[model samples]
Target: MPRPVYLVDFSVYKPPDEMKMNYNQAYTLSRQWKECVDDNHEFISKVFQRSGISPTESYLPPWVNPATCKEPKYDMDSAKKEAEMVMGGAVADLLEKTGTRPDEIDILVTNCSIYCPTPSLCSLLVNKFKFRPETQTYHLGGMGCGNGVMALSLLRDLLQARPNVKALFVPAEIVTYCFYPGLQKDYMVANAIFRMGGAAILLSNQARYYSTAKYELLHNVRAHTGQDDGAYTCMGWGPDKKGVNGVYLRKDVPVQAAKALEVCLRRLAPSIITWGQYAEAARNLFERRVLGWQVPEYIPDFTKCIDHFALHAGGYAVLKGLMAAMRLPTEKMLPSFATLRDYGNTSCSTTWYVLGYMETCQGIGRGETVMQIGMGGGMKAGINVWRALREVKNVHPAWRHVAHAPVTEADLPRPINDPEAAAAAVPAGDIAAAVKASFGADFKATTAVAAH
Candidate 1:
């Protein structure tokens, strides 16, 4: 099938629970562990040794307070409970925001990596949202940080197949649930970095949404590395106290994964570079004397080519790596850095918030391109390109600027996604359980297998 033009519409929910930290307040605190502990044994230093994030006696910011390195303070039960509630709340809010009822949504894609509840689809959302019978739903698990794009890609494909069908793509990953007590460098990075985030995007292939200037998903590209165990590997979650599963993140993630991007991009988009460029590249490869020598020649004029860049807002180093790999200027990567420094990494939904921020405040120009990139465990990377068709307007409750914003850390919210752990916990042995209880098993398991 020719690439389908999929219109992207999104809803981001940073629950009230996540607003516990002051803006960059938590990161600021976590950044001071060197003084809080011995420089050689500081938490940041251990996890990011390669980055030279050693303890220093240098000045630190006021809000950059160290996380009480004590056992994770969150109650697994409570987090799941909250996720259960927030999951539905987010969907409801999405329905209300988009002015669409549950049954109206023809295709549903829900992702909450940390928690997959019993009667997964119907239990988590369908029943609560009052959906109609036979709503196609998919639950994505273990797709890690890059799964959001996977979900969107699936939705786009489905929408293209059934042109009038409306697809609701929701990425709800809550980090608070599985956080365990331990200063292990890798785990500490997960704790210090990942937080709560839930986003519900309404997607369609309808000509109307496109004519109105929504982000149209033009293409999707996926890259995987570390599969052979050199630098890339599968990332998983383990059951902790009370059976809450906390995820494992590799420390060698950033640099190791960077090398793999070239291979993945080429495989996914054999034509990402046109024949003319390919010929030039081929000449450079075979005949050193033939290719262009100008340094700026290979670096596309990102500013002129793309109107805005909503990078994953993954982290400082990751964003920097993307800039280098893409050979983009610093200005292009600012939105991502700003988002990470302020909100920390919201995992799956981070890139969407960046897009939303651009959509609301900065305003996307007509026919401009907005590049969205996401990367995470299993050392995955997802890049889905967007094109704006009209004037993008302001949408409130957006990601606030760290320097100029009035929204405080109080705005950061903890979003949850466990339906089984409600006041009445669903039994674990409910397998052979009805599809409702096994909501995400099919898709999540399948995605994991596909990645491997």
Candidate 2:
């Protein structure tokens, strides 16, 4: 039997108010993207109009001057400060909650997609916290937003092999380094949405923790579409026409993400869905493949298997695409939306903020289940299933200051172009028709596959 893994506690870093940037503030900052190019300014303004982020979101590596929107300092010292600001606060809070000493941590894993220095983030934490010299450290780079679940899956495997050991999982991303001052519209959007945030999660296999632990890790499934040309290039780092490096996001990212998520859900349904639902899906597959019948797609009602959903707060477009593909309700996806509105898509740590929101705002009951889905730049999708081990009474640090206010779709600010509403406007059967009309008949099959 596999050893049970439990999440005893977690923490999400909250940046200072000085680092906050609303839509208008971000628009003002976009003027610096190109000091001499008028077209670049217009393009960035257009992207900002379509981005569904609000005016009250926070950022990291504080700007030199908020009034004039001065460019942020990007030297190594600023990088260290960014790390300490997020990682330090998160690790300190998590350790305090779990009452686990630094020396007791058998394993330490840290991930930062674009900011991997010579002395890795794992090393910096170990030294700062004074962990035992024998403590094992692993660093993950270039894995993008999906790395949080990836790190959890790794820790799950490690704990299963080494009993009675505690592990620390840190997921962070520093947007200051990736900030682009170039003229590419694809790169400028990064400035509009990516923000500063990090999370620290404590996992252990000790039976002693099972009683007080908030959740038990049940299942983790990972799917990658990097082999496909469209998926691989959807989001990545590249140089623009002026040879300035930056992260480029293609316009078709949401569509590609929907396809990748569909592949992941197909693999995950059998493991967590009810046996009856699984059997029905298997029957549908058999009829389509063996019986040569044109069977409609089988979309498992995930709401039946999971009480809450912690979808990645990637952005408005990505969230809308996943919601459409899964046929999920707006309520089920509120946490993701709220996180984006408040925190501004903090990369790998975005899922944790969503999870925290679900716990404090949505209220998870004992024995309830949560499905965490993350999609990242690898054109990758990851799913982790966690079951509440007990009713949680303690408020998470991330939600401590947050008001006990309810959120709804009406409360969220609408983007200028509102792709989510546009996607929802088409009838279920006509989704393919709309895709064909938009992206030509050759691309119709791809959209059709994702819709069902």
Candidate 2 displacement at residue 153 in angstroms: 2.0
Q: Per model, state how many residue pairs clash.
A: 23, 2
lDDT of 1 by residue, 56-140 (tens): 2111111222333322335545555556654665667777866787878888888776666666743567776767678888888
Tens-digit lDDT track for model 2 on 20-131?
7755665566556334267766655554444456666556467432333465565667777788889988999899877888989999999998888979999999889998
Looking at model 1, residue 102 earns an lDDT score of 83
What TM-score would you give candidate 1 relative to the actual structure? 0.72
Residue pairs clashing in model 2 are 22-55, 23-55
lDDT (Cα, 0-100) at 154 in candidate 1: 70
TM-score of 2: 0.89
Which regions of candidate 2 fall more than 4 Å away from where they truly are? 29-37, 64-69, 282-293, 415-420, 425-452
